[model samples]
Target: MENAILLLKHVGYLAVLRDMESFNFSKSLLSKRFEKMIVEEEKKKEGKNEKLLADLCECFVLLNQFCISKELLSIVLPCLLKVGLDKDESEETQKEVEMAFLALSNINEYAIIDKNMYFSEMKEIIQHHQEHNNLTRLAYHSAWEFVIKRFCLDGSLEDVISNELHFAKEAIKELEELMNCVDWKRTKEEREKESQEEKVLLRWLLTLEYFLGSCLLWNEKYSELIRCVVQVYQTAKGNNEEIGSRCIYSLSMAAKNRAMKNEDLLNGGAVNAILKENQLPTMDDVNTQISLKFLISITGRLKGKKKEKMKEEHRKGLKRKMFEKMEEEGYEDVITSFHGIFVLLEGCLYPFISLNVCDYFVNV
Candidate 1:
C-alpha cells in the first residue's frame, strides 16, 4: 500500500496522461477504470484506509480527465464528498478528508456544473460544511477555491448563478471579520509577507478579486459589495504589491459601474490607499502598469464616462456631486491627498483630459 501510494504521488507530481486529444484511452475506459478502483476501495471499509484514499485522490486529480465524464463524476464525486464532508473527530479520517478537499479543488475546476446536478447541491453542501467549521486550513481554502472558480469560468454560468448573491454576502461577512483582525492603522513596513495568517488573507483577497473582476458589481443591488471592495482595498493595500494591485483591479471594476457613487469611494479611504501606492517606488513595471490602469479607470469613471451605454449627463451629475461633496468637506485637505494620486492620473486617464482640464489642481 505504501509503495502504491509512493508511486501515485510521484506520477501525480510528474502529471502523467494530460494530453486529451488522441490519448488512446477512451473516456469509457478511463471512467470504468476509476470506477473499478473506487469500488475496490469501497470494499476495504473506505474510511479505514485514509492514506490509500489520499493517494487515490492524488492520482485521480493528476489524471485530470477523470471528471470529463458525468458517469465517472457520478461514481467518484460521492466517494470524495463522503470523506471530505465528514465531521467525525477521529484522527484516522483526517488525512482522508484533507486529501478529499485538495482533490476536490483540483477536480471541480473541470466539472461541467450546470445548475442541474453538481452546481447548486455542491454549493449548499460546501457552505454547510463551512458553517460547521469542519474543514481544515487546507480544506477551507480548497472548498472556497471550488466555489469561486465555479462562477469565474466561461460566461456560461451567468444564468446558473443566482441573483440572490449568496457568495457576495458570505464573502463580505467573512472578510469584514478578517479585515478587523488586521492592524490596518499601522504604517507600511518592509518585510517578507509569509506569516500563516497573512498568507491566508492574501489567498482570500485573491479569490475575492475574481468575483469583483466581473460585471457582478454593475448590479445596483450589490452596492454594499462595492463598498466592501473599497474597504478591503483601503485597509489591506499596504500588505503587498500583489494584494494592492488586485484590489486596484477590483476597485477599477467597481468604478466602471454606472451605479458607482464617487463619494462612496473617496470617503471609503480610497484616497489614502491611492496615495500609499503612489508613494511606493518599489513597484516593478507590471505593478506600475496596474496602478496606472487603475488610476485611469477611476479617473474616467469620475469624469462621467464608461464604454457602455448610459446617460452621459447622469454620470456627469455623479462626478459633479462628488466634487461638490469634496468642496463641502474642504478642498485643501482633498487636494493635499490628491497631490500623491493625480501626478499619475492626469496624463493617462484620458487623451483629452490633462493637467489643464481640472482648475482645482492649479494650486496642487
Candidate 2:
C-alpha cells in the first residue's frame, strides 16, 4: 500500500507539472488532480510513505520558476504548501516546508506580473495558511509581499494598492495570533529548553523578522514596519546580533522606500526611535552597509524619472537636503561620491534645449 501510494504521488507530481505546461488544462482540472492526490496520499500509513509523499510534492516546486500558465501554476503550487503543512513532523519536515515556500514565492513572483484572474484563489490560499497553520504562515506572509511588490515596484499596479491594503489589514489581524504563541516570547521559563528547540525558536523569529520587513518594504507600511523593528530590538537586543542587524536592515529599507515615495510618515521618527530604543549599531555600521547601498540604488532608480520634472531649485534643495543628512550621519564620503556621480548625469533640460537650438541654427 505504501509503495502504491508513493508511486501515485510521484505520478501526481508529474501530472501537475505537465498540466502547468499544458494548453488544454484549466484551473479546475489541476484542482481536481490536487484533491485526488491529497486523498490518495492520506490513505497511506505514516512514516516512509509520508516522507515519500513530501518528496513528491517538493518536485512540483520547480513550477514556481516557470512563467507558463499561471492559472495552472496557482493550482499546482498550493499542493506543495498543503503537503508541507499536512506532514506533522516538524524536525524532519523542515526541508520540505522550506522548499514548498520557496516554490510558492516563485509562483507569487510570476503572478505579480500576470493578470489578476487568479487572485481570488491565490488570496484564499494565503489567507487559509495565515489562519490555520504556523508552518504555512510564512508562505502566506509572502503572498502579501508579492502584492506589495507588484503594487509598488511596477507602477502599473499602483491602482490596486488600496485593494491590496484591504487584504493586508486582514492578514495582519491573523499574524497577531502568532505573537501570542509561547514560542514567540521565549519567556524565562522556556529558556532552559534544549539547544535544538532553541534553534527552531530562533528560525521562526527570523522568519517573522524577514516576513515583516518584506511586507513593509513591499506595501509601504512604514509605521508598522518600524514597530516590528522596535519589537525585535526590544526582545532580542544585544543577545542576538543577527536578528538585531536584520531589524536595522529592514528599517533602512522601509525608510528608504518612504523617502522615495515622499510618503509622510508620522513624526514618531523611526530612525531616532530605533536608535534610542536599542543600541544596535547605527545605519553607518558595517553590518548594515549593504542595506544602505541597496537603498541608495533603489531610491535613485525610483526618483530618476520623476526628478527630471522638478524645477532646478527644487532638485538642488532636495540634493542639498540629502547631502546634509548623509554628512551629518557620518556617511560624508558616500554622499560626496554620490554628488560626483550626480554632476556627471546629462541634465533633464538638454533634449528640449537641443531641439530648439537646432531649429534656430537651421533657420539661421
Candidate 3:
C-alpha cells in the first residue's frame, strides 16, 4: 500500500484523484481507517505503536498536501498535535515531534480558515509544545502566519488595530512566562551549551517584538509593555543582532505612537535602558534608521508648561544624548551603509525636515 501511494505521488495521480467525484468518499474512508487504527493503538496495554502512528501522520500530511481538502485536515490535526506534544524523552520520538510540527505548521492555516472553532485548540497545542525548542520556533511562525492572515491583510486599519491589540495582550503574557523559565545566571559555557534553547528564546523575543509593534495604540498596558521590551533588549542586545534589532524596532514603534511620549518612556526607565550602553555594537542599517527615527520623534514631540520646566529639562537632556550618539556613530556612516543610497538618504533627510518644521511651529 505504501509503494502504491508512492507511485501515485510520483505519477502525479493525486492531482487527478482530488478532482474526482469519489474524492470525498475516499477521504472519508481513509479518515475512518486512521481513526480506527488510532483507537486500537490507544487500547494497547503493553507496547506503544509510535512508529505506526508516526507513519500514519506522515501519510496524512502527504495526502493533504496533494488534495488540499479541509476534511482531511480536520481529521489529521488532532492526531498530529497528540504526537507533536508527546513528552517522551527519546531521540526517535523527538524526530516524530519535529515531523508532526512541520506538518502542522504547513496545514494549520487551512484548519484555521475552514473551522474557525479550531483556532483556540491550535493555539493551545502551540503553547503546550513551546518547551520543545525546535517545535516552538515552528509554532511561532505558524501562529504569526495565522494572525497576519486573519487580522492584518486586506483589513481596515481600525479592525486590524483592534485585533492586533487583543492578540498582543495575550502574547505578552505568554512571553513573560517563557522568559521566566530561562536561567539568566548560567556561566558563559553553560549558556553556550544550550544552543537550541537559546534559539527558542530568540524566537520568543522576536514574537514579542511583533506584539509590541502591534500594541502601540493600546495605552492600558503602555508602561508595562515598554518595560518588557526594555528587558528583552538588555538581554538580547549583546547576544543576538537580529533579536536586538527587533527589540529596538519594537521600541521605536512604541515611541512613535501618540499614546506614548518621552516622559512615559523615561518614567518607565526605558530611555535609560536604551541609552546606557555606550559601547554597544552597531546595529544593521535598518535598525539604525528605526532607532534614529525614534529619537527624532521623541525629541520633536517634547512639550512643556512654564510650571513643568523640570520635566522639559529632562526631555531635553535625553534628546541631547540621542543626538550625540547619532553623531558619534556617524550619520554619514549610516547613510552610506545602505544598499540603496538614494532611498536611505531620502528616508533620513526628509523625515528630519518634516519633523523640524513641525517642531518649530509647535515651539512657537
- The true-versus-predicted C-alpha distance at residue 321 of model 3, in Å, is 14
lDDT of 1 by residue, 277-352 (tens): 5445454444444444555556566654555345777667766765565455454364555556555554555343
Residue 174 of model 2: what lDDT? 37
Q: What TM-score does model 3 achieve against the real structure?
A: 0.48
The Cα local distance difference test for each model comes to 0.55, 0.43, 0.51
Candidate order by lDDT, decreasing, is 1, 3, 2
Ranking by TM-score: 1, 3, 2
Clashes counted in candidate 3 amount to: 0
Q: Give each prediction's root-mean-square deviation over alpha carbons.
A: 8.6, 13.3, 12.1
* Per-residue C-alpha lDDT of model 2 across residues 66-185, encoded as one tens digit per residue: 433544444454455465444354754644564555444444333444435434445554545545554444444444544554444355544343344354354334334443342534
Off by over 4 Å in 3: 1-117, 123-194, 216-219, 256-266, 276-286, 296-364
Q: How many angstroms is residue 101 displaced in model 2 relative to the true structure, after the best TM-score fit?
A: 5.8
Clashes of each: 0, 0, 0
- The number of the candidate with the highest lDDT is 1
